[model samples]
Target: MLNPIDLHYEWFGVLWLEEENHFPIIVGYWFSKERSEITQDAILSGFSTWTEIGDHSMIMRMYQSIRNKQKKQDWEKRTRLSLRTIFNSPWNEVSPGLYLIKSRDTYPLHVSAILKKKFWVWLEHTAVCETKEELQAFMQRVHEEHQMEISMKNTKPKFL
Candidate 1:
């Protein structure tokens, strides 16, 4: 049996973030009836890539240290939402370190796709707000997009 509330928000939406680095990484996470499936594809098969370039000089040193072993940069999970990040992806990159930060908040809404196995989504990384007010604005825009989807589904074209 599934909880009514959980079932309703299971299929919210999907977004991907691709960070540019020596070894680029693309992560796609989906929300399923199983919370374990909410990984958004953070699984590790071989080597991992660190997206945030927090302290440029420090990151450079970290890069040097892991340059051979692979997956060097150590990231701070708590500040993924407010750091200075640089996203080279085609999606709308926003802020400096936002790609790593805001990506965490996405937990509220489940993935929007039917994911079978872990895969990569090339959607451009973008976060249009920094503060709560700004986040609300961005969310409002998302809401509008959601309404558009619903509207399209509910309405049908007339045949002459």
Candidate 2:
């Protein structure tokens, strides 16, 4: 099985050509990690970890800095209701398959981006905070709740 590998010197993942004697051309980054596969051309071109940094409002000009920008404006623009936008600043993953997003326009407008992967990906989410404390609390609560539900389902009581 062709597993996605993390890129060197970056916090991202990439799929490289495994064929020996062939250039390790990137295929694509891990998007869903489910049913998503690298396309022929896409494999050649490849993709990096799509991270956002710097002033993403209108693309700021930077001189020399440690942090770098990785947002694909063109791609994000095409995708509607994107978690990241001029309005929404902090959109992050709280847990695996779960994302917590918030924006200034809708202050305290907590939204969730749930990754439903049947074949590829279908993001589904519903609301929290800009603070790390709030985010952590929210995530912990959700995780506990989910565990409880799973436990309940597994423990089938036998009626006397």
Candidate 3:
């Protein structure tokens, strides 16, 4: 039986195979932040993958296969997101105060530049605020400084 601490967060959303109880497959999503109940039935309701462990030698093979597949899928998703961003926005410029952070490829340099001038420099990366107030302030600064209208499309990622 694998300890609960042994599991990783990336696999939290998916089902896991348990080696104990004759390789009984269990489906659950682990909430890492909370540590109250060790075994809760509510958290174990989901779909199950394969859970079959033969001997000690076969355990390694099953573990490796699951880990490899998860990593590959994660990498593919990131690559797709990156490509989408690049296709959407081919040109990007570095602003003076704020670093250009790419989220879905459209580099809102003008908006970011305005934020740097209006807000404290420390707030640039210290927090990724998704509230309406922060985004409105950022857009307002951009419009006032550069006379450019920030569109909703550019600010969707900041909130979502």
Name the candidate that leads on lDDT: 3
For every model in order, what is the number of clashing pairs? 10, 5, 1
Summed over model 2, clashes come to 5
Ranking by TM-score: 3, 2, 1
Q: How many backbone clashes are present in model 1?
A: 10
The residue pairs in collision within model 3 are 85-105
* Candidates ranked, most accurate by lDDT first: 3, 2, 1
Q: What is each predicted model's overall lDDT from 0 to 1?
A: 0.29, 0.32, 0.34
Runs of candidate 1 exceeding 4 Å displacement: 1-125, 148-160
| Cα-based lDDT at residue 63, candidate 1 | 33
| lDDT tens digits by residue: candidate 1, 1-160 | 1112232345321223445664433233234665444334444322244343335465344333432232111111112211111222211232211111242243232111110111222212223232467455544544453332211111111100
For model 3, state the Cα shift of residue 75 in Å.
Answer: 1.9
Q: Report the alpha-carbon TM-score of model 1 versus the true structure.
A: 0.19
Candidate 1 lDDT score at position 14: 26
Instruction: List ranges where model 3 is wrong by over 4 Å.
Output: 1-24, 37-67, 78-91, 94-160
Best by TM-score: 3
RMSD of each: 18.9, 18.1, 15.4
Judge candidate 1 at residue 36 and give its lDDT.
43
- TM-scores of the candidates in the order shown: 0.19, 0.23, 0.25
**Which residue window of length 10 is worst by lDDT in model 2?**
151-160
